[model samples]
Each structure stands twice: as C-alpha cells, then as structure tokens.
Target: MTTQQGTALTHALAEVPGPLPTSGVIHVATPHTSRFTIVGNHLAQHAELSLTAIGLGTHIQSLPTGSRIGIKSLAARFPEGETRIATALRELEAHGYLHRTRVRLANGRITTRTVFRNQPGPTGAPHPEPPTPTSAPAPAPAPAPAAAPAPAPAPTSAPVPAPAPTPGPAPTPPATRGSVPVPAPEPAPVPSASRPAPVPQTHPPAPAPSCPARKGPARLLPQPRELTAELRQTASMLLADLRRHAPELVLSEADIERLTPATATWLERDARPETIRQALTTDLPQPVKYPAKFVRHRLTVLLPPPLPGTEELPPDRPTLVIPMQNCEGCERGYRSRVPGHCRGCRAQLSAA
Candidate 1:
C-alpha cells in the first residue's frame, strides 16, 4: 500500500518467471471518453484507484509476447486470495481490457486464448469464467465384460384359506304405521303491472321548481387557478431570468405552464426572488446541453425540507403515482429510475 512497497511489487512482477504477453497500453478516443479512462473509472472510485487491482492491470499490460494468463497461474504468482485475483481479471474483461477464447489444441485437448486489449475490444467475446459445456463429446464404445452368475429358485408352498362369517337369527317387524298426507298446491298471484288502475279526479298544476343549485368547476385536480394577471407576468419574467443563465434551453408553452407551478412552490416556501434567480442561474456552465435537467437538480436541492411532524398526508387521500417517462413506441408511462425508455421498449430492443 506504501509507495516503496508498490514500486517493489511492480518490479517483482516485471521479472515474472516464464514467457509473458507482449501487449502495451494504447490510447483511444471517443465522443465521451477513452477506453482506458472507462476502465480506470470503473476501477477508480471518486478519482482514487484500487492499489492491488490497478497494479495487477499494469502488470498484465506489460506482459511479454506469447504469454497466457489464467486464473490459476495468476493466483500462483499473486500472494492475495485466488478469488480476489479472479475478480480483478473479471473486472478487466468487463471494461473490455481483456478477452478469453476457447482454443482446441492439436492433442485433442482444449485451452484458453488470453487476448490482452489496451483499448476496448469488439463485442461477443467469451465469458472469463466460461461455463462447463452441458453436452460433451460422445465416448467410444467398448466390448462387454464377463456376465454375473444367476440366482437359485425357491421351493413352492401350499396356499391358506380365509375364514367365513357365522350365521345370526332374524327379528320380527314392529306394528303397522300410516304415512302422513300431502298438502294441495296453491296458485301464484297476478303481477301488479297487469292490473287496471282506479279512476282519479284532475288536480291543479304545481308551480315550477326553483333554479338548480350552482355547481363548482369540474377541474380534475384542484390546481391554483386564481393567480392574478400581474402574478403570471411576474412568473414569466422569472422564467426569462432563468433562460439568461442557459440560453441554449428552449421552453414550450406546455413547459412554461408546468414550470410556473414550480416557481410558485418556491414563493410559497418564502424563497426571495433574487435567491430563486441565483439558485437557477449561479455557477452554470456555458453551452449547457440539458438546461431543463440543470434547473431541475438545482430546484430539487433548493427545496425546503418538510416539517418534522405531519409531513405525510392523511391516509384517506389517495396516493398519486406520476410517471417519470412514457414509452415512445407503446405510449404507456412508467415511474422508472432511468429516463426515456420503459420496460417494454427495453425488452423489445433485446429481442430485436
């Protein structure tokens, strides 16, 4: 873990006893990052690298020509646990730095093909811990061996008879008893609709009913609708100020309608207009790719935490689950952690 110890370890690995791989580090550039950066990032958390794994990687990269690496061989060379060495190799493969293929030898036996990649390799490489083949080659047929001896027969015995039941005397019946008489059936009554109505005298006309009671607006949600024209203009001005921070972002009418409620939320929390503006604009990078996302994260962070008690709504109120994204293909929505794609579309892509 110390500097001197790491240098000594590196030197020791450099003089490893047999033939080594002849691979060297190569730089590759992509739109996002290089292959080395990707691998390093996977190994490096918060810009700090794991010492043992990174050392193993450096050693693997410096291996000489025709040198093959395997879990068992690396385990023998490394003083650490075999499982740990295997895991590091797996990490290497996951980051596309290493690939392994199954090679059949001339002697009718198979071995591994260890391919060291300085940059990202092509897709569809075999697994590092390749599975044991469920269907193996058929074995050659052999001649039958000597047969076993037969068993001897036993002597026959006479069968036994089962016992019969004993006879019993019969008893006389009791004095004669008469059966009860059945009742006659009754007919069903006629329906009231089929009967005639009685004659009635004419009555005076009733006065017209009073006007029906006025009902409130049929809004789906009781959203705030009483904001004055002045407040709306102020909301528009605040949004315009947010736009100055990231001019690349464009807002639609619907987006404005949706965002006005957010500004209102900040105001209700007693956030000052200048403070809100700073929250939306302060420290923003130039040429922002996703202004909506930038503003969303800042707004969420600036939100005041809920009160200690009574933060939760009453149980009687129904919980509303808002979908984060809707599938472009199926048009169904889901509250997924990942953006843009739903479960169905993901599965559909895999199948395709």
Candidate 2:
C-alpha cells in the first residue's frame, strides 16, 4: 500500500471501536474510523461480544445491537441485582459511553423502531432527549346567579299523636316445677375381631408391701447431750474400748495429749453433739481421743453413771478423764488456725 493510504488505514484502525475484542482475540484492521462503526464491525465479526471483553465489566449487556432486551434477561444474566449491571449501564448511558435500542420481533422478524443513546442522531437514528415539562392550569371560577330571593319566617303547627302504648300485657302462664331428667344408659362398647384380646385383671400386683417400720423409734433418736457428765463418761468408755480393740490406729502420744484437753472442753460445752455420736457409732474400732485444743479452750466435761463393781477403772480400758489446765496457745484446731496450711507444722496446704 502507498504511504498515504497506509497512514489513513493506521489512523482508522487506531480509533477503531464500539468495544474492543476480548483479550485473546486479534484486532483486525477495518476501514471504519467511527468508534461506533468500529464496534459494530467487531460485533458483526465476532457474532457475540461480552461487555466484560472490552473491560466494561460493570456495563450491562442486555441491550442488543438493534433492540432492547427485557429486564428479565438482564436479571437472568446478573441475578445478583440491578444495582450491579443495570446501574452500570444507566451510568454509562448517562455519561455517553453506551446506547440502547427498543425493537419488536414479530413473525420471526426483528424490527428496530426506537434507539436510546446520549448522542445526537442522524435522520433515522433515535437519540435520547430530555422529557418535556407540563404545568397544571388554574381551576375555573364559580358562576353567579341572575337573581336573588328574600327569606320567609317560619310558623308553629299541631302536635304529633303519641305512639299507642304497647297492647295489653300478654296472658300469664301457670308456674310449674320441671321434672328431674333421667340419665341415659351408656352404650355397650362394640368388640372388634381385629383388636387384640383384653388381658384379665389380676389384683393389681398387690402394691409392693410397704417396708416394715424402722425397729427403733421413728423420729430421729435424740442425740445424747455432750455437756452432761454422763455423755462424756460414755464417750470416754467407748474411746477406751475402741483403743483396746484396735491398737494399730496410731494415736501418737502427742495426738493423745492434745485430744485429751479437746475432749474435755467438747464434753463441757456440749460442742458438736452429732460429731460425738458419730465417733461413738462409727464401725471402725480405733482409739478415740478428743482433739486436745478444743478440750483446753471449751473445758467440756461429761461424767456418766459408774459401771457396777468398777471404782478406779481397769487398766486395760482407762476411762477418759479431763483435768482443767491453764490456757496454752489459742485453742484453734488445724482447720480453724491455719486455713491454708496444716496447723500441726504450719505447712502449706491446698484449699479444699
């Protein structure tokens, strides 16, 4: 080609448009210089072109080359909503970037009768135009009558007849007591062959016999008072018996000494009668000594009735006897003294 012809062709191709081909497609030179005509040429060559192919992802493709596609088609392509593609199309049309056309298809033939675009059009090309404004007209005035008439005064007249009083009272009926109604007999239930036979009733499995009344008194037996001399004597006797039976219980000398005073105080003040009872009744046979600290502080003493033929008490089982002594360290026990440690040696202990 000649230099001028080649330059013209290059310029024409440079401004080639409607929309560029997809990234992978080749852009062929075309004789058209108009961007719209270039785009139409590309569209004709490709048969179909997506707005996305031209880097117009947001632009709607519902507008056909020569006809307007329905909103449903737009919705199907962009199911997300009009806000995405439809908005983009509206914006592009508003900014003169795109155009739309409305056409009708009849008898298998398509006809484009209207075109919508921001650009001015040639004779037959439809162009987008601003809507015309219409103002409302003033209302018509009311008509005047030809003549005026004078008003007349009103006059009083005869009174209306009072409505006739309701006719004479209806005839009175004799008072009679209603008869007592008889209850209807319930109908016998019909038996069905398909239904299972009813099982014979046996004396409702004689309500499992009630447990025998407890042998001892029903009400909880009153625990023996700890303060009484009798209760202390009983506890001492029990402790001695336990010790004699089970020597392995490891009642250290110190433990015994400490318990002796605590036992005395516990017996004197009647402290924890329940604990005393449990100690006596526990199944284990072990030496029982009143915690020493408690005995020193509270000084409880219990003296039970003397056993027959026993005066000084036998050596095998010595009775617990608490003697009053001067106060040593404050009489708090392990749990009460060092809550977070073992009181015996002041060693740290875990919280319960």
Candidate 3:
C-alpha cells in the first residue's frame, strides 16, 4: 500500500479506540500484512513500546514494558499461543491500557464512572526517580571584515523622446452624479393577416411484410400395441428403427424390455399397419411403428441428452428409472402420489 493509504489505515485504526478483536486472528494462509501492520503499530504507540513488546505482550502480561520477560513464560500465560498477539493487545485495552466510561442509574439518578491509567513504569523492574535537566554555555562570535579604499563617480546622460500614441475612441467615464437616461424606440407596424390554404393529409406507409412463422412438426402420440408371443421379436424391430433413423435415442437391451410394453401400446394406437409389420421383421427396421416425430417429442420431454450410446449395453446401461421397490407410503406401486414418504408401504421418507 502507498504511504498515504497506510497513513489513512493507521488513522482509521486509531479511531477504533482499541486493539483488534480476539477473533480477528491473521491466518497463516493468505496472511494480511497490511492489517497486521495497522494493529501492531497502534498497539506499539499506545503501549509506549516497540513491535517486539507488542509480540511479547500477547504471551506474558497484558502489556509488556521491556525485555525482562522470557518467551516460554509468555507462551504459557496466554491460552492462544503465538497467534494471540492481537487478542492480548485487545485484552490490555480492556484491562485499562486506555480509558473507558460507564453510566449507572440508581433511584432514577445517573452516576458516571471513569477508568484509566496515568503512570508508566517497568513491568517487573524497580521504579526509578524522574531526572533533572541542566543548561549549556553559549558560543563566541567570529571576527569582522577588513577596511577598503573609495573611487570617483561617472557622468549621467539625457532622457530619450517618447513615442506617438495610436488613435481610437476614448473610454467614457461613469455617470457619478445620477443614473444615465436613454430614449425608447417606437413599436413595429402590424401587417394584414391572410387565411391559410387547405392541404390534404397523407396517411403513413404500411409496415414491411414479416417473415413467415415457423410451425413445429406435428407430435403424434404413441399407439398402444398388443402384448403377444412375438414381443421379443417386435422389440428387436423397434430397437433397429431407433438405431437407423434416430441413432441419438439409443436404448440398451434391458431398456428395450422396460420400454417395449409402453412403446408397443403407443405404436398400436398411432402407427399404420405396414409400419407395425415392418418393425416386427428386420434387425434394422426402417419406417418402424415408432415414428421419428413422436419419439423425438417423447425424448425431448422425458429424457435429457446426450442419450446413452449402443456401446453401453443391457445390464450396465444407465436406466431412466425412479426407485419404486424401497417406496413405503402407499399400497399402490406408485411413488409419485406420496408427499413425504414411500407410496407403497407408507414408510416415512424424503419427498420426491
């Protein structure tokens, strides 16, 4: 910090009226040297000692006067160890390094109480008497300069001619005797007024045409498909369709079983007969029962991407499921119905 800033900090510290708070310890990590300087300087000046005394004061007595005490004893005396430098200084102020006042009321009458220290002495040393001052003798002056001879004066010359002045109006003097008076001019003649001609009002130009609004593709709800003996084969076809057309919506082998019932129902209700038949045959089916339009809508609404890839197969795949087995709030398999407990068994649990 600049000297001016440091001085300002010191002034602010002095205005605080006491040492730093006990809790305001300077940490080893990211040490605040500026704050340390402010606190250390203030304590040193107020306690009438050096910075060393400020450090020593923390461990030994509340206030350390000189170098008579040992560090070991100082450390033992203060509970906070070496880091108690700030706390100790504050304790000293609290214990009377500076003055404090208190007001007390008894029988509705106020009484003032004052506390301070006026004398200064060594912490553990014997008291000494005040010293007297002695006056010093005056010094002698140096000798004067030597004498010199005089000389004759020279003759003076005549003055030169003054130059001619340039011509212009002379400045007028102020009207001292009375205020200056002036004549007023006559008013302008009024002219004959004429009626304004009628003019047709023009309408503002129409605004330019805007770009056509974009309409999102229609979202067809999934058709409800019948559960039959060919469920496994049908699921394989749906998986193939997802891979071929919407590879981004990757689902694992286990995910296929989990999603098949709902997907089949969706397809049966919404898809064409040919789309359903195609989805049932090939490993990589095209134009399958689950259309890209509907699948994209479902994925956008229900799942966050990037979706799981084909590499993450079957049992190891990340399942988009809410744990229902541990639920214990209601008889039904549903967990969403419970507000603050498991819906299945009515057991107290966290809200979803």
| Best candidate (score: TM-score) | 1
For model 3 the TM-score comes to 0.20
| TM agreement with the true structure for every prediction | 0.27, 0.16, 0.20
Which regions in candidate 3 have their CA more than 4 angstroms from the true location? 2-5, 22-226, 229-232, 273-352
Give the local distance difference test score of model 3. 0.36
Residues 178-268, candidate 3, lDDT per residue (tens digit)?
1111111111110011111110010111111112245677644333335765654664576556655555446566666655654555343
The candidate, 1 or 2, that scores higher on TM-score is: 1
What tens digits encode model 2's per-residue C-alpha lDDT throughout 223-333?
Answer: 333446665555454444444544433344554443443454444444555555445344543344543332222222232332345456665867775443322344434
Ranking of all candidate structures by their TM-score, best first: 1, 3, 2
Each candidate's number of clashing pairs is 5, 21, 21
lDDT of 1 by residue, 111-215 (tens): 555655543333323334322121111111011111100100100111111211111110100110110110011111111111211101101111111122466
In candidate 2 the C-alpha lDDT for residue 31 amounts to 59
Give the C-alpha miss distance for residue 331 in model 1, angstroms.
90
Candidate 2 lDDT score at position 16? 70
Locate the minimum summed-lDDT window of 10 residues in model 1.
Answer: 147-156
Clash pairs of candidate 1? 20-64, 21-63, 21-64, 22-64, 22-65
